[model samples]
Target: MKRATSIVALALAALISVYALFLRPKENSIPSPSPELLAAARPLDTYDFDLVLHPDSNQLGVTMHACFQNRWSETLPDIVLRTWAGAYASPETSPAASDELYNRCYPNGFSEGGFVLHDVTINEQRVTPTFDDAAHTVLRLPVTNFEPGQWCEVSLRMVLTVPDCLHRFGRSQGVWLLGNCLPILSVYEQGAWRTDAYAAIGDPFVSAVANYNLTLSLPERYTPFTSGIFEHANGLYTTTLHAVREAALLVYEQSVTASIQADGTRIVCIGRNKQQAHKPLQIAKEVLKYYNQTYGAYPYPVLMVAAVPFAFAGMEYPGMIWVGENLYGQGLDDALELTVAHEIAHQWFYALVGSDQFRHPWQDEALCEHAMLHYVRARHGAGAYDALARLRIAAPMQENIREGITPGSPIDSFHDLEEYTTVVYGRGAAMLQALDVHTNGRVDDFLKEYVRRHAFALASRQDFEITLADVLKEDMRELLIDYLDTSM
Candidate 1:
């Protein structure tokens, strides 16, 4: 009897060991970040979110607990948050309401969508939040006697009505995009809060990096592709993203996936089927390899690319990117490759090296375009690079110059998407190309140094100029003025 009991105990111990080693969650197996990266991410704000998606009702219920420290020298009064999804509540406020976007965004006509705030608490004390705009996109919460270096905890409960549209923050065909839907803390700079309106042109967003802990519950059939490494267990999906401007998720009913590793970073591509996902996955792997060699290593552990019903060619997030679903069809091979390369470049330019994309759209957009040129030169040869430069950059830029349109103009300065793309993407890239010529093709080296200096910090126009001057050992004020200050 004693021997039989000992044998049963031994079998139970082995079964427990097997489960711990092999059947445990995948997130537990993820490698830890470098000590330097961890130290840089420790001081920023942190958000804990519990999200429940009701696909049948087209709504998302969220409970958020945000802890943020006042980093400024002097701080009092209130904290502000940007409820970007409110911009979709009506046609007048929607960025996609423009004539060029309305039809593409709302194939089934307009559907109202916005956040319905239920309650708010600061340090466990109940408080009421106020809306600073008619659209209710800017929310302010009054805090009592908050001081610098002191941390504040905010809790919120809200429900978001997902719009039926093809744009970001909406549902289209069986896929739902939850981009910029959460109420994110607003930027406070130079002794005041930056309450920039949601402009109808360009990507009108400016934010600082924050750590995110998110748990999402979706319907049984739904699968989510999110911004960070995630694991599934007991019908719940959990994710953790460190040092990202925002967390984005794309939920779909079904997907065919492909994955590859480039320089220790895993790249996953998801589409409706294998035919649509394989090519982009290969392109993403190639681009990641090139950028890692050219600039620096990608900061994140995993990068996800998903085919979405987006109006644009692609959209960039911290650890994820959305490729347009339409581009998956045949005869659009060039478009697909270019889009993948450009968005991957954003991982370096926009994600790792932070900037105010709203105020200085050229900072990231133009740099990505410039990086794309180098990628073309390396992968497709010098002849292909030259042809692409002439067709995409030089021609459109010349036209913008002829029209007296400045590439350095803010998003509000442009009347429509066409003009904004022509100036910011085309002409702005031309300015960088000119810099490459002036520096004897040393712009790549300059950018590598820039990324090293500003990784995980926000950079300004002045900062960029100073970094370039330091890299080249000569002042570039005159050349920058020629392109940024004057149209000619």
Candidate 2:
């Protein structure tokens, strides 16, 4: 009887153990957190990261995964890359055009003159021992060499010296500016250094940032107005930036002007010489409000508008943008307003959302411009918008896009800037606009959604377009196809 009882007990224990093994599940089954290194800085004035910037310089940190070095040779020959920077050995056949000569040719290197890089941090990365030879203050790095799903931070300490840049552009760098002219980690994808779409005639398109914190040290004489309010401040004179979608800084050293917009979203007519800027400021205000109401928050903490002399009409940079000629000084014509609105709108389109500008130009510029055409149409009633769209979009849509189109052609090939500009700036925009129009203007909604989804995230035209298709109906797929495939 005792042996039988023991056997029963053993059977019961075995059964209970089997049940526990199956039901309890495995422990430590959860995976570890992915590797992510955020770039932290003092909200605005407080730089929490490791950037010990020079007190009086115009250079800003490009906080990213790039380590400045000489590794660019891995993708292209040193000479080939050098020509892009204006150090050309061959003149006519140079990938860079003559107009682009000075931008890349810092023969004396970063320290040659204006806003130069003073220091760099080497944390857990290898770099060239000496950046002595024509070092464009470069930290050559395989920014994407680490784990595929990781991120890194880098920052620049830039000083504001518009006159110097103006000297280069004939006129000063304008109040609405967008161009990358500092040393940086060239974007690496598919194992090659990413070049700008117009590498044949212009400079490279530096990658956009995930997050940026700008600290401007301006004189107390100038009213410090940025995208977001001053999060913290030393006193009335200096302040820290809170959080912003995307912003550019504008400092009017010419006057002790001070007037804040009613929305408090901008500095308003703050410059002492604000008269020339009034009408345009009104346009900027109206357009900005329209964008905020329709699209999404503007990117960055400030929209720095510096009136520089004009070589080209205008340009863009990070945290700060420039429009050639003081917007105050210019007459606010529809054409002028359109340019201003277009550049301002870029605050959200290109600045906030990320893309591979090198491989696909239309992904951002064309898209943003396209969105602007719609923006004008929406804000000023369709009639006004329709007329503007006629010369830019409607006509472009009527063209044969595929036949005469070359993948890479010189800008001069077109009869006018309008024709070439349309393909890139006009038609590219029309394609998306037409797509939006087809999807019951759903593309516009998707564009805003795309910006919100990709806020500070990298994507390709294919990435956005595909994701867009997901949001669109099954019937809407043809719209995207026609725009991509059709020339007219």
> Which numbered prediction scores highest in TM-score against the true structure?
1
Tens digit of per-residue lDDT, candidate 2, span 396-442:
66765546542123343344344556566766677676676666768
Query: What are the per-residue Cα lDDT tens digits for candidate 1 across 162-252?
Result: 9998888899878899998898999998877778888878888888899999999999899887876568899999978889989999998
| Clash counts for all predictions | 0, 68
Local distance difference test, candidate 2 = 0.46
CA shift of 431, model 1, Å: 1.0
How much is the lDDT of residue 372 in candidate 1?
88
TM-score for candidate 2, residues paired by index:
0.63
Clashing pairs in 1: none
TM of each candidate vs. truth? 0.93, 0.63
Candidate lDDT values, in order: 0.87, 0.46
By lDDT, the best candidate is: 1
CA deviation > 4 Å runs, candidate 2? 1-121, 124-138, 141-179, 192-203, 210-253, 256-264, 267-272, 299-306, 317-320, 326-332, 397-419, 475-482, 485-488
